[model samples]
Target: MVSVYKKILFASICIFALSCKSKKEEATKQNTTQQATLVDVIIAGTQQLSNTIEANGNVVANESLEIHPEVSGRLTYLNVPDGASVSAGTILAKINDADLQAQLSKSKSQLSLAEKTEERLRKLLAVNGINQADYDAALNSVNNIKADIQLLKAQIDKTVVKAPFAGVLGLRMVSPGAYITPQTILATLQETNKVKIDFTVPAIYADLIKRGATVSIINNNEPKRTAVIVATETEINTTTRNLKVRALLGGVPINPGAFVKVLIDAGKQINSIVIPTNAIIPDATSKKLIVVKNGKGTFVNVETGLRTSSGVEITKGIAVGDSVVVTGVLFVKPNAPVKIKSVKNLTELTKEQ
Candidate 1:
């Protein structure tokens, strides 16, 4: 009975040891499989961001107008030189002036007959063969006919349409023999050679926007072009709190209505740390960034400054030489170990695309 009891106790101890060892091995494997999350990062450094204020802008033709007739009539002759240059005072179109011309002719014949009758009445009055009232009526008829002729001439002039200024014509909207009214648009004219940059800036910069002050223009990430401040709206917008500004472009003409960026020199360049805009982690209370420190991702709060087409300025929280996680921001957890796949510079991290 003692020998049987010893064997049973030994088997029970062996089973218990095996069970404990298996659990330990399983836990060890789980820990090893739970590796660090891989991510790409950018090294923060002081960058020379343009010490300028940036704003959205559009290319505007210096002079633009819709071609409309002063008088309404059937267009007997239409000469819309589409996409062609025209000089001031050039006749663009003509209305049917035949009726006005015929009226003018009839008035001239009536004036001639009235003048003859007035002369005969004057002669008769000289001899006391007619009353003074009769001579006066004859004289009044001649004056009335002359005035009618003058009125007809003025109406004929209104039937013609002329270019107001030298400009390039746009597509024609009306065809010949079309009975047009004052509201009808014949075409559009624009001075394409001269273009102005139209942009709005914050009202706080109102005092800085002066007439004839030079500013910079950038398009498609190309080199900067210079433009001079030409004019500004008198009052600040009540709704937007922005001041409308127009600058004259001095270089090659940009297509009207094309989007461009305006850069105004705001005193000096800002040499501060900047990071990719995507790397920012927006929080409810403050902005944050995933920073890699000692092989771990730590969320750090940061204050931002002037933002440009390239990157955002980091005014506070992030330091120079810090590793800021650019990619895999959502997958990273606070105080969790992360794998650094590669480090990039400010330019390589983000582009204006």
Candidate 2:
């Protein structure tokens, strides 16, 4: 009986040891499977980045003119229609010049009579039939009459309106036969072959913007054509605390008053790592990023610099050629196992891409 009891105790001990070992093996297998369930990651390299600031602006003509009447009369003939294309010296409108014409005719008749009298006096003076004073009076009358005729002619010419410059005319403000004065507006003309985009930048960036500094302009209405900055205002606006900038657009026909977007480089180039804005993970303690190190996924805190629509500059906590999980970073944890499905090749990770 003693021997049987001893054997039973030995059998129970063996069974207990095997059961504990099985449990330990199962726990180990579960932990390994959990660690292997991490998602894949891809990486990018640091590169020199360019920063840009975007602003809203308006498209304007380089030269704009407001056409106004120079003579007080009824607007008679509008030779140029509304929105008409006109060249320099093109007749735009006409005012009633009957009064001016009548005055001119009277002056011409007086001038002709004065000339005849002067000629007769000259002949008489040469023959000693007239006094020198009388001949001088006749010549003075001719001169006065000629001046009167010239003044009348100038008035008449003022009644006819002509384009000051070659451009497209805006809507006509006065119609035919409308009573007009010198203050009356006839039309507006705008030169549109090369357009200007006007924008204001912050006063802090005034030093960076200079004359001939390159800029880009994007039209909200037409996104295809981009304008280049041609000029900048030398002085800053005191009231607005901003500096004025103008960009020239070539081959794009833009009308005055059209809105546009302006982009200007701050003139500082940096050699920092840039990544898409969405790749940044913001946390309360620090700005973090999911980076792939040693073929495993990890969380790394990073410092950021200038931000743009496409990406943000990584100032620290990331290195060149370090694979970062850009798309699926939200579902990852530090030191987790990951599968790298796609890696951005060196050629694809360059500055432009």
Candidate 3:
């Protein structure tokens, strides 16, 4: 009878212990259910956003040429020094033309003699002392001699090289009295008052690019520069399937053949709803944002536009003045109770970071 009474006491102690554990678990679950998620929210507003396309490009001079002589002769005179700025029609160099000069002088003498003979024949023909055919022969001789003089003059002009346009000359390759040929390179000349930024884009963007469209450029370690789209290739490249484009840069100095980053403005400025980039949660087909409304978390679907450095442009879904949850997004679900910890602007949030 004493052993039965001890067994009953042990069972009662076990049941009491299980009841206390169950009560503790029920209290813990109730506490968790009553807790509200804390999130940082931001007010969406309209801002001006530039729509641009980023590309790689190279800089080039507005005009460039590898200057060379048109004829073969010894360089007698190099009037312009190396690396000198010259205007159009400025004498650059002269080739030896002593033989051609001698020929020119002889032709002038012959022309002068033919003129005198023609004058005498005209007077004689008036008196009927010479036939019409004889006078015509004298006149033809005068014209032929004059043509010879003009030919010699053209050959002499070819020996004197002049600058084709206003530009800065590059290094000099030939010296005075150096025998050079038409194939010999004298130097390079480039007009760099402005520059051309050449770049390429995929054929898909062909319709978006047009003449007079503006673009931004940044060279190595240089500030951003603006350029205007001057021209584009009509045909697309088959190998790369890209369209070649050229833009003119003014006010900013750039070297020829310099590698640069190009940003073409594809759209004009317009008011767009922007929000913090962290607030967006991208899914496979769409993006989601946690919007705080009436102290609750609301999931919203949004269509995105231009993406900026600090924020992203929202074209659809959330409207202006809507509070978007930026913090504690991972811990919250739709329609869950939420407490706003702080409301900050997108730019302010960017600055704080």
Model 1 agreement with the true structure over 96-179: per-residue lDDT tens digits: 988889889898989999999999999999999999999999999999999898888888988898888888899999999999
Task: Please give the clash total of every predicted structure, in order.
Answer: 0, 3, 0
Report the number of the highest-lDDT candidate. 1
lDDT of each: 0.89, 0.79, 0.88
Candidate 1 vs candidate 3: the lDDT winner is 1
RMSD, model 3, all Cα superposed?
A: 7.4
Tell me, by TM-score, which candidate is best.
Answer: 1
Instruction: Sort all candidates by TM-score, best to worst.
Output: 1, 3, 2
Please give the RMSD of candidate 2 to the true structure.
8.8
For TM-score, candidate 1 versus 3, the one ahead is: 1
Roughly what TM-score does model 2 have, to 2 decimal places?
0.63
Best-to-worst ranking by lDDT:
1, 3, 2
TM value for model 3: 0.64
For residues 151-173, what per-residue lDDT tens digits would candidate 3 score against the true structure? 88899999999999998898888
* Poorest stretch of ten by lDDT in candidate 2: 344-353
Which segments of model 1 are wrong by more than 4 Å? Answer: 1-35, 111-147, 219-224, 235-241, 283-286, 293-295, 350-353
TM-score of each: 0.79, 0.63, 0.64
